[model samples]
Target: MSDFVARRPIWSLVILVAVALLLWLVFSVWTPGMEAAFGRKRVFLSALFNGITLGALYFLVASGFTLIFGLMRNVNLAHGSLYLFGGYLGYSIGELTGSWLVALLVAFVVVGLVGVLMQVFLFRWMEGQDLRQTLVTIGLSIIFADLLLWSYGGDTFQVTTPDWLSGPVTLPLAVALRSNGEAVLMTYPLVRIAILVGAIVLGVLMWLALNRTRVGMLVRAGVDDRDMLSATGVRVQLVFVMVFAFGAGLAGLAGVVGGTFQSLQPGEDTRILLSSLVVVIVGGMGSIPGAAVGALIVGLAEQFGSVYMPTYAVMLTFVIMVVVLAIRPQGLAARR
Candidate 1:
């Protein structure tokens, strides 16, 4: 059985695909019932869109966590704090300059710098010390959270989008609906579309960098075996620093993008941090593709669960994590 499972995971893949198809079939057939229950067909579409958007944001944040943990083996618990800091800083800058672009750039650079500083002053010394790294980062997160609350207050704040992305885009639904006997159109926020596009682009770029570039080669080698990578006359520390900074920059960028749609609150740091952890765990620690897939699953699960099972919505992510762990304790794509 073990040999067969190892030789042909094809059955597992097939089962997954079949399950997805079954779900789709069931949902299609049950659309009318859902509309009857929810009083609208648009609810599903709205939830789906929200899921995609939230998933993109989760991917951005988790990608950074994946890189830092996957390669450096550093458990930076304060990652979400950096995300919140970026959002608040971006919001303040945007308000002052009245330019979202500027805020985005500043937030990315500043938060990235902060990440680099944290690594140099705090994490660099604690290399290979997981316990120390975790505790220190948690401490930093707490300090940052308090500082932010004192400065920004407990009031929730949201970033303003550019004029072009301020409205909704209408999507034509070609399929005839049972109720209308005609095609229905759907409208979704333009920003959501932009977020999805941005995530795809970022994922592609990261893939290329890891697979096609020299630096990416080094990072991959490091992930596989750090001591060997260092012995090969390569500056592994420098690579680690650069990767950490880049990951921090990605987190900051996500903050600005997410803040535009979702309000930034005092506890958002912890919330996003928890979400990123789930993404990493479900996707596999340190796997970029895994993070993307995990983020999408989480996003969809959260949104759809909220609509269909409001009472159980919060437990959906935990359920997914538990299921994934039970089936593959190492995650969907654990490092071999």
Candidate 2:
């Protein structure tokens, strides 16, 4: 970042100015004129928070995608199906057991095991065959989608939010001033905040595990040259299988999160799969940090566009993707 700022000082300055303006808009008390021009402060604030939380959700889904497609070079296009399956499975588990946390674990484990089967029986045989992987996974995704539709029907389902995280939590940020001269603080759902926090923590842990551990070294080596790693008496295939499982498990976990905050029905798999692909492309393929940056940018664009320019809202996400592709086809944070 420092090097880029030095090389592109003008662009850096523009970014700083934009951030400052955004901060002022968020923190300052809007006068009547400002409110008239920009709508209510509460609306803006809500959009901003919603964007951030949504980005967090995207990160959960895309991180897994980057791991499988980017790192492992396994084109699991059936990923969205995995996410939808996980959500449905989690919902069923949650219903039967009445435990949200347990549902989370079960989804992760079950979906991860499914990933294991894919890696062992399918992807492993077609190693380095991108076109084949793509076709096979597409077929699998269709089959999975049809199966899920058959079981769940066309009805939408939302996972029950746990009791502790169900209510709205008051934030210190003031959205408006009350008539009595008191500030009207912002209030947001606790679950969203928790999801954001969890994403950040998981991201950090993943970075550490991938960069700081011996297993990480093996994984990186395997990605770079599995033949060499295997020749070194390492179980490179096993490592890859684990990575695939973990990545797929993350999709399952994200499914539960999505089901909790949003409704699950047919076609959501496509939406989320596209979102993950866009995020990975924008953030940089095979880059964890890139996924984070892309997710945030996409999330903010979606929410703010919807709130401010409803007609062009859906187009805004694609516009951002196009701009990113034009400026940095490799992505914002390409893997080193």
Candidate 3:
């Protein structure tokens, strides 16, 4: 018998599918009303939509985090502050201009600039000093949280979804039925679909830019070896700043969408930051697909867990992370 054989990507995908089917089967038995509830088709579709939208938001936030960690090798504890700040900025801008497009653009630019400034002023000095940088970012996160609390109060604020997206719109997947002898229907939010589509397009574009573009080539080279890239005449410092700014910009975009999709509040900074950190760890530092996959699992797990076991919802994330780490200390998709 051959000791080694070439394995195709399809094999991995098949395994994944098999595992998913098995999980569904197990849940069907262990959790009553699950499969039946989902069998309604509308509820299942709704959950699928929710998962996709949530996953997109996670990817937007985690991509930049993965990027920065890949390039600068920093944990960026303050990324959540950037997210909160971006949400606040977007809200303010939208209120002033009454245009979601303008608000989104302004938010991205403003947050990206902040990222650039941080790189120039604080991170530049702290390069190669991971501990000091980590502490500084932690302090910054605390300051930002406190400032937001003082300025915005602890109340959660919902962003204004554009008029077109404000109300529940009829969707193809929506199903109508009778509830307790009364007519009822399941509806899908148009905005959620938009978020899912936007996230997918952005993810694809990002993948292309990172893998195909000249700047992306430099970035990849830098990731493999900053020293060698620098020695070979690439301006590694400049790349670092650009990558940092890009990552921060993505986080800002996530914040804006998150604000509208859910709500923004003072303490959300920590929550999102922690979630992003967990995502990075489970996905493996610096892995894009890993981040996406990990984020989907974390997001869906939390969402579903909240419905099933509210008390365990919070711990479920950390628990999963711990188990994944225990099994593959480097993470699920860790390349190294």
Query: Each model's TM-score?
Result: 0.91, 0.96, 0.87
Q: Tens digits of per-residue lDDT for model 2 on 1-336?
A: 899899889999999999999999988999999999989999999899999999999999999999787656776789999999999999999999999999999999999999999999998898878899889999999999999999999999999999988999999888889899999899999999999999999999999998999998887787677788889999878998999999999999999999999989989999899999889988988788989999999899899999999999879989989998998899988845
Q: Over 4 Å off in model 2, which ranges?
A: 1-4
Where in model 3 is the C-alpha error above 4 Å? 1-44, 174-186
Cα lDDT, model 1, residue 127: 90
Name every residue pair that clashes in candidate 3: none
- By the TM-score metric, which is better: model 1 or model 2? 2
lDDT scores in order: 0.88, 0.92, 0.81
Clash pairs, model 1 backbone: none
The sequence of per-residue lDDT tens digits that candidate 1 reaches over residues 77-174 is 99999999999999999999999989999999999999999988988898999898999998999999999999999999999998877898877643
Candidate 2: residue 117 Cα off by (Å): 0.5
Poorest 10 consecutive residues by lDDT, candidate 3: 1-10
What's each prediction's clash count? 0, 0, 0
- Sorting all predicted structures by lDDT, with the top scorer first, yields 2, 1, 3
On a 0 to 100 scale, what is the lDDT of residue 226 in model 2? 72
